[model samples]
Target: MDGLTGLLDGARARGAFLLRSVLDPPFALRIEDRAPLTVVALVRGAAWVVPDDGEPARLDLGDVAVLRGPDAYTVADDPATPPQVVIHPGQRCTTLRGEPLTSTPGLGVRTWGTGPDGSTVMLTGTYQLPGELSRRLLTALPALLVVTGDDWRSPLVPLLAEEMSRDAPGQEAVLDRLLDLLLIAALRTWFARPGTAPAWYAAAGDPVVGPALRLLQEDPARPWTVAALAAEVGVSRAALARRFTELVGEPPMTFLTGWRLTLAADLLREPDATVGAVARRVGYGSPFALSAAFRRVHGVSPSEHRIGAATGD
Candidate 1:
């Protein structure tokens, strides 16, 4: 656990702070998000986002919206009309008077942060590094969390403020990690408190299903059978099947099959491998069988995936 904990310790990512504006009615966070996701807790006013293939959603103060993937969206006041974009990161510090990523009804303060070189506004001062309890508490948290409103001036608030400032040696790394933990803690609290959607974060502390999930994710290609899995994990097959379906919204076997094929498709994209080789690696007996399943799952054949990968699609 220590080695794995330290694995992502040196994982450096860039942080940015830009305040600019664009004239266009439809505005958005144009720049690609960092490898690490961006967490924004709007301090003032409101924001709205139109996700691709989804309905427009409004965000209020104390609301934290996250985009885990790179998809262009229109964040606006009205869904019918485009909103002006301003204060986008790209336009900030650029020579040209670039259009803002999002329109600002008025000048607002947004604290944008990344690895280093990112500006973090500290409203309060002081941070507390508790012992093993803190680490355990952090690990028990959900993936995303938002703490908002007047009551934010709690003890954690001052600690967060101090963590934002460069006051101690190695503090940058320490504070960054602390912030990550704090965010996780806040999110965990949110999930347990309810009104949250059912997402991956909901799997945190599920007694029966969580262990099974860890197994599947850690070894997607395992020759997992309902009986084998149940026996290994010290549960009856019926119980494992019921619990998996309840938490994951899919049966154990179904999830395993999809995960195996996903890995197989990835291997098929490798320049060195033939379709036949990828099939064997993913538990398929032959190229024809793999192709049938691939086409059924992905619409495209393995060959097409290879072609797309080679052509930079």
Candidate 2:
């Protein structure tokens, strides 16, 4: 798979938070949900996304805006609009004073709003858990990335709006998959714009480094070396190293080590995963070897990392 696809493969949105927000002209919502990622699409009318640290961006119909979070942001009819509702972690809606507003009557299936016939309408999907998105992919995004409707064409906005109101069996799973697709589409479109692709993404199109990267991602558990990777990709070790470093901004082996450790860190978060098993799964020869490397690179032992993740320390 290509690098973008490989990174996106990790996005398994389990019961992802989704909603169709309908609001009147004078409305604002302060979102402090701290979700890892969120996609906001304007279905009707227009809206403004005011990120905590970036300039406010206006979204017209069919425009999609991606917001990276853990930091709070505001969505409103205008950048100056005061927030009337606050969405907390777990998507709990409340008034400004922490009074629960979740029971405030819903507009429709998976739909909520200030009024029934509000002027602005938006569809939102949030990946609540950090694990739902790979760190590799998240790191490549800005705090706020917008794909204007004029830049690309996609039918996902309408499709998602239709599916949001469904209540059939396995519907949650379907929405999750749909959200994933929408995210991928938006990102692919964003990255395809001139001068917007990340280094690794650009490197994926290089003849010499592309195949080598695929091999590494497809079989990260294999015992791989620069020379071996070069041979497998039909190039000399020195040549491959130069091309890979130039294009991807890292040596092949260095990149492979980071990829393995990233996989190990994610695997280590599972309750049933033991250090030895994770080590073996990520190409280390033994638990001790993996532990040393992990500590050196991440400044934590496998056990310590697991404990911290568990306790949210």
Candidate 3:
């Protein structure tokens, strides 16, 4: 159910990118220093994208990359041999095409970006994450992933393409959300690959562990004991622990604890949910115990989590 649950949640957190003419080029653009979780999809022509820690990569249509850190990187057509004339972040962008992309009066939502040849080479856009799970996903994604030219018939892509032709109300917000879902699909498909990946990603490949993970994800507070869970899948507790540790990098209980805490944190963020309610939801009988454990893990109490979460922390 973790995979299915992830799919559903991902469908909700989707976002998008639209290109307006004001910033159209004959000019260049850079990230301008301040770092945010950026998902850049090259929906048009190919360009050279340079990350701080990595070399310049060729980003073409359907190519997606997440700029993990805030380090500024140059995304331009040419390999900045001498680099372009630079300016400060949030300061004057000295690039010739400094006009506002969205301010272009004739630009429409169903419109597209124009390439150097005046052809719609790409439909590029960028977005940031909404939830912690999504943020973690952004961090975990490879620096560059090009999903183009039949890289699986992505439902997200068609959704994006179809949206571009519609004349609906609140279309921009709708497009952005759809873009976020595309990211989740891309991430999911990436993790479904085998060999050489993080433990959690690799865990998706283990027959028993995969099912077990789904079970845990389905209901974190279901009084799941190691012995019972192991037996449910016809393995001894020790065998289950060994397999889980090998693939998931933590014993089942430890993984469950972390997952429960994540759910508990989400619950704590709810305005109507109290400490005791969150505690019970996460499998604890006492708020005191949950608070103590939560503080030990998060360096704050349930109350702090509620307050911080309420304020969009």
Candidate 4:
């Protein structure tokens, strides 16, 4: 897999919270949901995304904005509008005073707003939990990033909006895949913009290092060494090492180890996963060996990680 695809593989949305929001003017939401990520698409009227630590971004019709969260932000018709509602964890809605907000009426399936004929329309998809590989992508983003219609144009928003209100079997799975596609497309466009691509992303286009990265990520269980990787990539060992380090900011083996451990860590989160199984899957010879390396990098053993993941601690 390519760098972008490999990074996004772990971030696929499954039963994510999605909704079509219709509203009139003077609408604002103080979002402290602590979700890892959220995608907002302005379908009709305009809106503003105000981040706590970054400059406010204006979203015109057909624009999409991605908010990397765990930090607070506000979405409103205007930047000056005060938030009338606060979105809490678990997708709870309440007034600024913490009283449950019952005034917002349901417009239709998977939609809520003041009324169906509200002037502004927006579609929102929130990833409530962090993905296994999302850490790499999230670290490369700012608090908020906006992609305008003029920069990148696609029918994803309209398509997703139509799918939002549908009631049928397996609809949630469909929406999940759609949301993943929209997010992938948006990030792909965003990363293509000047000065926005991360180091690993940018390095993926290099002829020498790109294939090497794919090899490491595609088969983490393979026992790989510098000479083996270099021979496979048709480069001398020293040349491959120098170029990989210069471009990827790490040696081949170091990158391999990190990739292996990342997979192991994610696998251990599964309730049925055992350390021995995870170790074998990620290329370690024994659970003890994997534990030592996992602790050094993650600061926790596999079992400890599973517990913490389950408890959200």
Candidate 5:
């Protein structure tokens, strides 16, 4: 798989938190949900996203903003507006003093806000993704990034907006899939802009290195050496090493070890998965060897990771 696709593969939304917020003027919320990733798309009127550590950005109609979190931020009619509500973990909304804010009522399915006819209409999708694979891509994002509707054109905003209000069998699953697609589309456009994409993502397009990367990702279990990879891609071993490092910012084997361990780490999250089986699947000959490498990189053994994953640590 290509770099972008592989990174996004780890971010698929399943039973994601979806909300359609309808707000009138003079509304602001201090968001501290600690969700790993969030997407906000404006369908009508406008809003401002104020990051705690960065400049505020305005989202006009059809605009989308991605917020990488754990850090707090604000969304409001104006950047200077004081937040009346605080969104804590579990999406619990309360007053600034922590008392539950119960004045606003739900408008409809998956919809909540101040009023039903509020001028500012926006759709929000929050992904509380688990596993190291998700963080692998999220770490590349800035605290906040905005994609203007004018620059990148996609019908997902409207489509997702339409889907948000539907109430039917398996509607949650449908919304999750739509949210995932919207996120993927927005990220693709955002990363395609000049110099915005991560180095690894940018390198995925290199004619020489791209094939090698595909080979590695496609069959990470293979006992791949630098010379074998170079030969498969029709390049000298030294040339492949130099170019792969130059483009992907790491030597091939270093990257492979990381990929294998990332896969192993995620696989360990499965309750039925054994350490030895996971080790073999990711190219390690034995559980002991895989545990050694995993500990060196992640500072934890596979069993420890599995326990932490199970307990949501």
Candidate 6:
């Protein structure tokens, strides 16, 4: 798989929180939910996404906004609207004074809002915990990215809205996949726009470094060297190294090591996986070697990381 695809593939949603929010004008929501990532598609009417640290951006009908979070932001009918609702972590809803609002009658399946016929309708999908691999993709994004409706065309948003209210068996799994598709489609369109794509994303089109990056990502378990990678991609070691570093902003081997260790960190989270097993899987020769490298990169041993993860520290 290519680098961009691999990065997004890791973001497969598990029990993602999806909702259709119906609201009237003169409404605002202070979203301090601190979710790792959120995608908001305006199904009707318009709204403004005001990030705490960035300029406010408006979302028109059919426009989708992707927000990178754990930070607070506000969504409202207008930039000047005061927040009436505060959405807390875990998708809990409350008034500005903290009275519970979840008990407010639902408009329909997987839908909630101030009223059934509110003027503005929006679909929200939150990736509550984006795993280690997806974090790589998320890190490259700005705090708020909006794919204008006029610039990109897709049927996924309407399909997602249609499927969201269903209650059939395996419905959640279906929604998860749909959410992934929507995100990928939106990102592909966003990255294709001039001057918006990140460096790594743009480098994926390079003849030499592009293939080299794919090789590294495709089989990170392979014990790869600069010369070996160059040979595989049909370039001289010096040429590949210079070009890869220039485009990717890191030496090839350094990037590979980081990739391997990242894979190792994720593998270590598996309940049945042993440190030695994860080491071999990520290209390390032994647990001790992996431990040293992990410590150097993450400032924690694999065991400590696992313990902290388990304890939620």
On TM-score, the leading prediction is 5
**Higher lDDT: candidate 3 or 5?**
5
> Global lDDT of each model?
0.48, 0.88, 0.60, 0.85, 0.86, 0.86
Arrange candidates, best lDDT first: 2, 5, 6, 4, 3, 1
Winner on TM-score between 3 and 6 is 6
Arrange candidates by TM-score, descending.
5, 6, 2, 4, 3, 1
Better candidate by TM-score, 2 or 5: 5
Instruction: Tell me the tens digit of each residue's lDDT in model 2 across 1-313.
Output: 6677777676778789999998878989999998889999999999999988889999999999999988999999999989989999889998899998864385878988877788889999999877677767777788999999998888888999999988899999999999999999998999888677777778888889999988998899899989899999999999999999999999998998988888887888787999999998989999999999999998999899787655434
**What is the TM-score of candidate 3?**
0.73
Q: Give the TM-score comparing model 2 with the true structure, all chains together.
A: 0.89
- Can you write out model 5's per-residue Cα lDDT over 265-293, one digit (the tens) per residue? 77787669999999989899989999999
Give me the displacement of residue 164 in model 6, in angstroms. Answer: 2.1
When summed lDDT is taken over every stretch of 10 residues in candidate 6, the lowest stretch is 129-138
Query: What would the TM-scores of all predictions be?
Result: 0.48, 0.89, 0.73, 0.89, 0.91, 0.90
Candidate 2 lDDT at 185 equals 91
Worst 10 residues of 3 by lDDT: 19-28
Q: In terms of TM-score, which candidate is stronger, 4 or 5?
A: 5
Q: Tell me which residue pairs clash in candidate 6.
A: none
Count of clashes in candidate 5: 0
lDDT of 2 at 100: 88
lDDT, model 1: 0.48
